[model samples]
Target: MTFPTPSSLVFRQLFESESSTFTYLIADRTHPNEAVLIDPVDSTVERDAKLIKELGLGLKFGLNTHCHADHITGTNLLRAKFPSMKSAISENAGSKADVLLKDNQTIEVGQFVLECRATPGHTDGCMSFLLKDQQQNPLAVFTGDALLIRGCGRTDFQQGSAASLYNSVHTRLFSLPDNVSVYPAHDYRGFTSSTIGEEKVHNPRLSKSADEFKTIMDNLNLPKPKLIDVAVPANINCGVH
Candidate 1:
């Protein structure tokens, strides 16, 4: 599923089936040698590395939107494969990384610049990365788990707060232009992406009032993630342990 991206940018969305996680590969077409990978899964490092190498791209950063509990990150493994690559995550994520980012920070690779927005809900360190075109118009947003296709991430643990998530979506994410595409970290419903306008009107959870959203989240009764016990601790150390 390809979203409409600018001709100046090279983009690919890779999936890891075990966790249903989506890893994004983005680079400036003018500087294909420098590329960024977001939300890479540990098990698919080889696959990602091969793609990067095949494209003749020099992996610059292995970025995680938050400290994931469902799967270990591939940042460490990516660094091992591409020695110059750096691992990055939100400073508030309570995770170790080569670069600890903050809200509103910008990471530039060639002509592409990613604006980081702190959107904590599923976890205290969750972030969303926004890309803009030459005219400064928003192109797309990589929403780590704050907002999904039709639903949102579970806020039952890891300092998850339903109210906070609700506020983040309404204030930070929903504020973007309706045409801006939304790419989430994980999707269970086979959805690849959605538009801001689509989510605003159609999202079952986020479209509701704050109190109603909270009530819905509270009654979900979802099971704990299978990998939480091992994945969380390993991710804190950048997924090497």
Candidate 2:
């Protein structure tokens, strides 16, 4: 396939079928060979690596949106392959990431810079990565589990608070331009993307008032993730024993 213009970005949305996880690969077309992977799954490392090689891109960083409860991250494995490539996660996550990303901290990928936005609540350290064009216009926001297409992440566990999640979404994500694309970490349905405007009005759980949102979240009574017992601990140590 042809690449994008030098001033643009090369973007790919990869998936891990088992966990319904979405991993994003983003690179600056000006330096097409340098890239970053977000929310990578341990089971998909080989596939991700092969795809990176085929695209002639060097994996420069492995970033986790948060400490996931469903699957272990591929950060350590990617770092093993590319020692210089950093591993990053939100400081609140308490993961052993090479870089503890804070709100507004910038990460470089070729000529593209990813700005971290603190979007906790689904998890204490959840983050959303925002990318802007040279004109400083909104491009896309990688909303981990914090913000989904028509729904939001479950706030029943992992130090989650529905009130905090509601506040974060409104103040941090909904405040963005209406057109900014939203790429979430996982989607149970077949949806590929959504826009901030869509979620603002359509998100069943979070679009409601904070009090209503909390009531809904509190009553979800959802079952815990099947892998939480194993995944949580492994993820804390970057998936290493």
Candidate 3:
């Protein structure tokens, strides 16, 4: 479903099928060509770069929500392609990045600003980016793996904690306005996006009591990610080869 956006906002959600990852490109159309890319995948950096160039956008930052274990991030490659662009990640993630973001830290892309919210539990350093309009009304949130459409990131690895994830979502994310759009990093199912109100009611896992949520997470029995070993190490260094 399409979320209503301001006419001056340039937004694109690109997907990488192998990992089922969603990469977002956000920019201000009224500004002088500045843009930022969130949760970029290594395999799709070329495509992202081509699109940025074609759109005449000067990439300002390649940001990750956390250190991903399923796939390498495109931040390193993006920096290589666009020398002026910087790589950013949460400071708690213990990863190498040009900018180590803190909770509540704001990153500007021309006239637009993205506020980083510390939403760990999926990982020690997981973050969600909140984009607001000029008047400070919530527009959309890039939830990364912390929260998903009708689901959430598994709390089985990467310093995962069910209690922490539960708290993060309830306090940091659920508090947003009901109309704020939710954009997650990955989607195994066909869903693309959901709103805070929709997930609060329809999300099977997060909508349950905290104790129930933790119990469910502990028993998920999901298999290990295929690329954990390689992806984790590469991602720790900001996806450098």
Candidate 4:
């Protein structure tokens, strides 16, 4: 099916200050009331819902790119407000997902399709969502902590493996067209977006050999996320806590 028009797409980038997480909202402007949200935070549920309502958009889906450890998800709360809204995550994430997405699965929105590509590394079930045009042209990729502007998610916990992450970024993401925009789940530097070409040549971590990448990931003894204890459990249950 062909999309209404490029201008008929409603895309919003929302952020949560505490976790520096980016939540995206995509809807067809032709049907202004139907929308999908990605990587929503528990604390921002009311804020997100208010914006959706203010825009006269009805929530259709609450999707998590993966199980998060830094902050809780708002999928349950969103479903409470919009009973018809479904929650989804990667099938291997081992969480409660109304929809357990498989690799390469396509999520049908109004007139667009979100292609799910498993990019496990930051976590065993990390997935990226590729938003494509009706003609199947590449638009952008919502790379959950898997690939960032110039950095990436920590590969020291939650079944993280630097080798897996390197392979995912190289084969799954870098293979895309150079112009494809990359929208990561978090960015502490406040920068917004990047492209596949830029990341391939400039991403300090992934630009190097796989062996070096693994070495870097192994040596970085980063501290655990402040909310890991609370957030992980809450996120495991869809942020009901």
Candidate 5:
């Protein structure tokens, strides 16, 4: 689902590079004042804070697609700022998230409705948020780290699995409209975003079928994140780790 002009909701994309993570803010016009921040960056809360104030929007929600390994998330911080704002994450992800988003669960706020997709494999409860207008046509998807522009997320971290990622991508994310704009959790090479169709045609990983993806992911070796050990435990414990 592609749109001709601005989307039904107002969305802003931000990139934080201590770990190269991408954060997004999605809001609708009717409640143009109520906004949602996704996979917020801990190191850049002040920057986000600045943007929120500049945009003159009240943060209504904060979400994490999954527990992060490279950088701490600002989910708790944002919730603290907006005491009533709900913090969302997948169930049993060992998170302090307040709203446990389940598969196919829908959230209606103002003119936008977001559908929760239980896209695990990157982690036990990794999720992707599917957005649409009142018509239910596909608009955008915030794919935390489950999918990237030309590459899929690494499956070597805690709770990470090559097989799980393949299924999550092949069946879950890939099923969306090929033209849907993808906003990923991070991009290693600095390219901002890409569509699923673009990835399918150009992504080295997606060029292979499911079976081929599993085999290649299994044999490939990737270096651990520079701060994985330090970032993850803290992320799980509200920055206490």
Candidate 6:
């Protein structure tokens, strides 16, 4: 099925088998001429690029909300393909980006301008993108592992912290207009997304206080992700040396 996005954006979900990660490509629906790739994993980059070409959209930029631990980010590959395209990321990711993004930063993509919300928790530098329609209705927020549908990202790795995650969600994400949609970086069972209103009221993880959230998150007996050891270094170095 096709992905969900604001009325002025066209988004596609490309799955990477190695990590079950979803890479999204959003084009300005109004212009259909400008596009950006978000958290693109290396495995499916080529397939996604071909689709972008077929759609007749020019790749203008690529964004990595944060360093990924599940699969290699294809940012470098895409940057190479569209040499003029800027690789935009958080300012925290210094000395590497063609453009440094800051908290509450904004970027224009046709009729819609996505506002960056720095929701650090899953990783200290993690971020979420806020999409507003042409009329400026807050459409959705792309939570990059920091906030998931029913669950959240494990906090035992790279700049991850349970308390930080707790604050980030409640203060930064949950505080959004309930009508805003919640688009997570990953989800199992094919139920790819949820609305902020729904998550605030229904997410089991979000129901607890920060202290309780910390205690519970600290106890989760999750195993290290298979690709974490590989994907991280690759992503930190922009996919390669």
Using all chains and alpha carbons, the TM-scores for the candidates as numbered come to 0.98, 0.95, 0.98, 0.96, 0.92, 0.92
When 2 and 5 are scored with lDDT, the better candidate is 2
- What's the lDDT for residue 138 in model 3? 80
Question: Once model 2 is optimally superposed onto the true structure by TM-score, how far is the C-alpha of residue 205 displaced, in angstroms?
Answer: 1.4
Candidate 1, 169-190: lDDT as tens digits: 9999999989889999999979
**Candidate numbers sorted by TM-score from highest down:** 3, 1, 4, 2, 6, 5
lDDT of 4 by residue, 40-83 (tens): 99899999999999988998889999999999999999999999
For model 1 the local lDDT of residue 238 reads: 98
lDDT of 1 at 124: 96
Supply every candidate's count of residue pairs whose N, Cα or C atoms clash at under 3 angstroms. 0, 0, 0, 1, 0, 0
Clashing pairs in 3: none
Give each model's whole-structure lDDT.
0.93, 0.88, 0.92, 0.90, 0.79, 0.79
Span of ten consecutive residues with least summed lDDT in model 6: 1-10
lDDT by residue (tens digit), candidate 3, 1-241: 3567877888999999999999999999777457999999999999999999998888889999999999999999888889989999999999999999999999886667899999999999999999887777788999999999999999999999999999999999999988999999999888999999999999999999999999999999999999999999999999986
Badly placed stretches (over 4 Å) of model 2 are 1-7
What is the lDDT ranking, best to worst? Answer: 1, 3, 4, 2, 6, 5
Model 2's C-alpha root-mean-square deviation from the true structure amounts to 2.3
The better candidate by lDDT, 3 or 6, is 3
What stretches of model 5 exceed 4 Å from their correct place? Answer: 1-8
Q: In model 1, what are the clashing residue pairs, if there are any?
A: none
| lDDT (tens digit, per residue) of candidate 2 on 1-241 | 1222234678889989999999999987678656999999999999998888788788778999999999999998888777777888999998888889999998877767788999989999999998766656668899999999999999988999888888899999999988888999999999989999989999998789899988998898999899999999999998775
lDDT of 2: 0.88
User: By summed lDDT, which 10 consecutive residues of candidate 2 come out lowest?
Assistant: 1-10
